[model samples]
Target: MTAGSRHSVSVAGVVVDDQGRALLIQRRDNGHWEAPGGVLELDEDILTGLRREVEEETGLQVTPTALTGVYKNMPRGIVALVFRCRAEAGSLRESDESSAFRWVTAEEVAKLADEAFAIRVQDALAQHLTAPIRQHDGLRILG
Candidate 1:
């Protein structure tokens, strides 16, 4: 593939509470509610990127427990690895990347996020032994 056609890898973490509610962030740039994540730095490993992204967006340090799902944005050439994470330290506070944050139930996640994003949180909550792979057009699922 050409340099311009290369795909970018991103990591997202779904921080689940004891009540099974997942943490969602309202992105400062887009105002869309979704899991906390961002593009991985060239030198950073997956686990480090996951922890950094979660902390940067939510001000909470997290330990990833399981790989939840993998999603590819076909139109944007972006592949995201979603993980099930548990909060290990820090408190919830708004960061530069996020305007607001909340712990939401599965039903609330569906209402707050688009199908492309909601599925990630739902899959994380389900905790299947094998992660699901999916494709989308950035906002909706695709075949």
Candidate 2:
């Protein structure tokens, strides 16, 4: 959150269900659908950040099973840790940041995310077989 800093850390989830559909949220600010995630706190670890982000955004308790990738929001100069996770408990509820949520498959993620966030969704699907943690720079998906 500082000026001129080129790196910011965040954690996100690629939640899947029994049917293999992934969970996604419609961001309140831009109406773009994306995985549940948020910025990390000053003293928090990745796991804690992941759990808190998913819970706060979707009202779901997610325990990340695998890390899929690391993404850089180039425009904002922020870095994000992406994980393939599951909703261990809690029911889905729309929060201030998200207005809608749904369960979709790998194919459907493309529609929900469209072109802007295609890479993030692709990273999640690729992890379905082998979770590969990545670090890349690109246009901002959440911004």
Candidate 3:
């Protein structure tokens, strides 16, 4: 395949609390509210990258309990693996990647995040029998 045909992989975790709230981070670079995650390094294992990304952005050590969704940003050629995670340790704090953090209910997530990202968290919280596979253009989900 040509370089343009190559897709990058990213990992994200929707850190959920006991009350069923999910964590959202206001990204420092863009100020967009979304789940804590980033592109995976070439040598990194998926779960290790997920844990690193979540902790880097939200300052929380998380244990991924479920694979919630697989999303493709068609325009960007980015394929993201999203997981439902439980916070195992650490405290929430701001970092270079995130400006702020909030624990939001499922409804609040829809309002706070772009449609492309909001769906990821919703799928995680919904606890589907099979993970949803979806496509988007970065902001909106595709049909």
Q: Model 2 off-target regions past 4 Å? A: 1-3, 128-143
lDDT against true structure, model 1: 0.95
Residue-wise C-alpha lDDT for candidate 2, range 93-114, written one tens digit per residue: 9999999998877778776675
Q: How high a TM-score does candidate 1 get?
A: 0.97
Each candidate's clash count:
0, 1, 0
Model 1 residue 24 CA deviation in Å: 0.2
Better of 1 and 3 by lDDT: 3
Please report the candidate that would top lDDT against the real structure: 3
C-alpha displacement of 87 in model 2, angstroms?
Answer: 1.1
Top candidate on TM-score is: 3
For model 3 the TM-score comes to 0.98
Tell me each candidate's RMSD, in Å, in order.
Answer: 0.8, 3.5, 0.6
**Which residue runs does candidate 1 get wrong by more than 4 Å?**
none
lDDT of 3 by residue, 79-132 (tens): 999999999999999999999989898899999999999999999999999999
The lDDT for every candidate, in the order shown, is 0.95, 0.78, 0.96
Against the true structure, candidate 2 reaches a TM-score of: 0.84
Q: Which ranking of candidates, highest lDDT first?
A: 3, 1, 2
